[model samples]
Target: MSRDLHADRVELSIPATVEWLLLARTTGAAIASRWSFTYDEIADLKLAIDEFCLTLVEGPGAERLDLAYYLENDSLCLEGRTVLATPGSQAASDSGATGAVTFSADLSARILDALVDEHGISDGPGDGAKTAWLRKKRNPLS
Candidate 1:
């Protein structure tokens, strides 16, 4: 197994533009590689982050994007945050305020489901701020 790269947790904040998303991909790949992820796994992690950002960028307007990376014994977890366009929108499910955030039934959500091992969204720390997260486990061979 790979050693933890983000024992203290790492964060990246950038403008919500598509061009800046490359930074996220780059950061993700570097962290995954440092943690001994396979080439294929690193590529998958980059694509997963790209798709996740594309989804959020295309949907609502976000002032900024906040991403947090957590390295664990067997997995790397990424958390993304942004302010929602509508606080009362379908961002949260109808299941009574678990403060969960969800992607609209769209292509981005489908792509995310196919790529990452696990991914989800939730309310951020600030008001009207929402967050999405993805977890990619290290390959058993690593």
Candidate 2:
């Protein structure tokens, strides 16, 4: 399906640090609310955002995260991508010398599937960056 060209969209950029995850979640909740999502739906959206953003930020080399919130006709769509720091860069150094961090993809998928209408996590094409996206449809009964 094609997206509406005039759809409302908000973009946010935050440092790829655990401390900044709250900012991402708050932004998502705010946008979701504006779209008239139910409180429980908003909570689910926040949790899904946290899980996906944490997966990116907790890993080494991520310097920042870019998020886009799209207001669709009957749903809210969130797309987040990580910007990785170059090797030996200050940003990379600040991310800590700890080895790669890993998360259970299956678990994450299950959680996301339960929370949103649709979701995906994938590595950006040839960029080494990771992207996570989700769409939550508003309940008509609400």
Candidate 3:
């Protein structure tokens, strides 16, 4: 069985950084959302998600990035995907790729980590395209 209660889809343009930030905040609000996070925390979430976005966009050329949100009874799942291509089966082997982030970079990532409970990424060559995914759990304590 599935635990999700709701779903949302947002289209993001790679050049529009502000729009990306807005999407991050709105996504946070939609799931495990509370009104008490500090400014730094909010900023961190944007940065972390931005890294996720950048990483997803690095190897492949995406005309537009598709964002998806899954709201479950116990958690909110945030994911992004693009129909870009990678040189190899694993993006890591591709020089065009970059590294994943630690949870200590910004307050927002911390807040997201706290709220989402867990996060992950899975990248590979799929159906003649390269795709990467970033996912976060909705923290119960959040």
The CA lDDT at 77 in model 2 is: 85
Q: Each model's TM-score?
A: 0.73, 0.80, 0.46
> What is the C-alpha lDDT profile of model 3 across 39-79, one tens digit per residue?
44445455556655554545424333556555445444456
Query: What's the TM for model 1?
Result: 0.73
Question: Which pairs of residues collide in model 1?
Answer: none
**Candidate 3 wrongly placed segments (more than 4 Å):** 1-44, 85-117, 123-128, 139-142
lDDT of 2: 0.78
lDDT of 2 at 7: 69
Candidate 2: minimum summed lDDT over ten consecutive residues — where?
90-99
Residue 75 alpha-carbon offset, candidate 2, angstroms: 1.2
Local distance difference test, each candidate: 0.73, 0.78, 0.46
* Top-lDDT structure, candidate number: 2
Candidate ranking (TM-score, best to worst): 2, 1, 3
lDDT of 3 at 28: 52
lDDT of 2 by residue, 72-98 (tens): 768788888888876665453344322
Higher-scoring candidate on lDDT, 1 or 3: 1
